[model samples]
Target: MHLIAIDWGTSSLRGALLDGKGHVLEERSHSRGILTVPAGGFPGLFEELFGDWMRLTGSFCLISGMAGSKQGWVEAPYCPCPSGRVEVANAIVEIEPGRIAIVPGLSDVHDGVPDVMRGEEVQIFGAMSLVGLSDGLFVLPGTHSKWVTVKRGRVTGFRTFMTGEFYALLSQHSILAHTLDAQAPLDEVAFLEGVTQADNGQGLLHNAFGVRTLGLFERMPAGELASYLSGLLIGEELRTQSIHGGDLVLIGSPALTQRYQLALEVSGNTARTLGAEATWAGLHALSAIHIANKARS
Candidate 1:
């Protein structure tokens, strides 16, 4: 059966029409994120967005991301760690019986603190499928970067770092903001320099302050400082992680992943990246699980 994989996040909504083999036939994206819809408007909005595709393809829709959060269409309870697509599918909150359902996000505990992930789990599963591995270290870089650990196709544990958010706060609202261009293209030299500095014995607080000093002392140009600051933050994140075996998979947009790729290389590690299509493939994989379970019962 065809699948409609909808990744509805806080700031954007995107859908993919997938054939039986999980290949995307068509895709649609919009700014109508979960926050944009009214309290009672989710069903109406979903229908408006993909009603045609559903009717035409006889597709079963799987909604993922913030759309399954407490604020989205319906809050699907968090499925605990060590969850695979089978567990996720079993916990899915069905909106229309067999026709539509929301994929529940995964939850894990790290050092006595609880952690949760909504959309990133789908990407991780998709990345594993694409790379043909059941176990690996995966990092999803975004506003809140995630470093996830998977064992035998089930997510065992993960950690979240506010690297991107911190970068935004520093580059836009901190003293470093005065000397940095947030939108400047990546400068590999300046970025790698920052990466090297981050790996030093100095911690993040000390390394971060260097961004402003580099500008104040006229040591580094204002144009390259943004990339430098970014490298420092990403490098700090890498420094904290405990990477085990398997390929270190990076999943996200190219621009963000490239910097991470560079940072990973400098740290003497290599990475493979998968883009947004991972979301589509992930939902499709979950759909197959749902279907197989139904047939068994």
Candidate 2:
């Protein structure tokens, strides 16, 4: 059976028309994310994005991300940790009679702090499957970077860091605003210098102020300060959370993952990147389980 995979996030939506073997036959992307949809307009928005592909009958639709949040088409509850495709498949909501379903996210309480992720779980599983990995550390970098641990083909635990958001707030609204030039091309040397500087143990707050001093003293050009800031924040995340020596699987856009890969190398760890295709692979994996369940029932 053909499948329609939808990755509907906060600010964008992506859909793919995939053959039975999970190859993309057609795809569409739009700026209409959950936050952009009008109240009670999800069905309409979905149709507008996938109307052409929906013309086919009996094709199953699988959705993930904020579309399953409390504000989305329907609130699909969280499945606990150590979950596999079967668990996520069982949590799928029948949004429409035998036609559409929403995949559930994963939730875990780490060190007594409750945490949840809506869309990244699918990508995590997909990365594992694509690399033929049964266990390892996986990093998904984004607005909120995720450090995940998979064991025996299941996600056991994970933590999140607001590195990107922090960078944005500081560069645009904080004291570093004047020190950064957003349009500057990345200076690899300055970035590595920041990463190395971050290991000084002076603390993030104190280290952040140094960006201003460095720019003020002309130690580094203001144009390259953004890359330095990025490296500092990413470096801090790696220093605190990363294990020193292992092959880390980095997943996300090439542009973003490359930065993380460099930071990993600087921090004495090996790394590899898996592109955005893993999201579709994961959705397909879940849908296969759903199909099998339907057959048995």
Candidate 3:
């Protein structure tokens, strides 16, 4: 049987046509980002872009990122924290006329600290499948980074950091943009130095200004300053979050995974990197699980 899996994130909509074994047969991507979706354009945009894929695949499953939240196609209610595979599997929402299933994101409120996640939940499930029933910590680095702790096969707790998005804003639009240029290569030395500073307990707020001053004083090369800034932010997360000796799984794009692995290593945590395709794999796996459950019911 054929299956369709969509990873509709904030900046892009990605779909994959896969076989029963979760191998991708064909893929499609469009610029219909969640932010670009007009007030009433979700259904039409989804139909126009994916309608053909749906026709070709016969029946397909969808798990969206921004689309699953209150701001996307439809709000798939959140699954409370301390969630498991069963909770996620049971929280699927079906959009009519098509056999499309929207996976609900996870949310938690602990000690009056409310945390939320949308798309990374699927990626975590996908990564978990590869690691088996082992207890470990999963780190998905993105615009809004997520650090998740899983025990056995269930997600016990997780934390989110606005590292990527903050970097983009500060480097491109904020006051720091004046001191830094955009098209710059990474400086390994400066990047490692920033990591060391973060590891030593310098909060991100304390260190972000260093990017500007270092450039002004000509202490660091202008072209590689972005990497230094990136390292500083990621390092802060690694130090403050406390991943230490637990098994660490890094997900996201190749560039992000590589940098995060380096940061984790600098912070004394060893991590294994999982490729980008894990998101699609996990989505397909969840779809298969949903099908099996329906059959059993």
Each prediction's TM-score versus the true structure: 0.96, 0.97, 0.94
Candidate 1: Cα lDDT at 22: 91
Any idea what lDDT model 2 has? 0.87
In candidate 3, position 68 carries an lDDT of: 85
lDDT of 1 by residue, 1-297 (tens): 778899999999889989999989999999999889998999899889998887965679999999999999999999899888778888878889778999999998878889999989899888888889888899999999999888888999888999999998999998888888888889999998888898898999999999989989999988899989998999898888776546789999999999999998875788888998889888888888887887898
Candidate 3, residues 1-297: lDDT per residue as tens digits? 677788887878888888878888888888777888988897788778777767764567666587888888778998887887678877888876347778899987768988999888888888888766358889999899998988877788888899889899989997788887667766667778888877666678878998899999998777778888888888887777865586888988888888887777774678887875777777887787777788888
Tens digit of lDDT per residue, candidate 2, span 203-226? Answer: 788889989999999988888898
Highest-lDDT candidate: 1
Worst 10 residues of 1 by lDDT: 239-248
Model 2 sits at a Cα RMSD from the real structure of 1.2
- Displacement of residue 13 (Cα, Å) in model 3 is 1.4
Model 1 bad stretches (over 4 Å): none
- Please give the lDDT score at residue 215 for candidate 2: 90
At residue 108, what lDDT does model 3 achieve? 77
Candidate 3, run of 10 with poorest lDDT:
55-64
Clashing pairs in 2: none
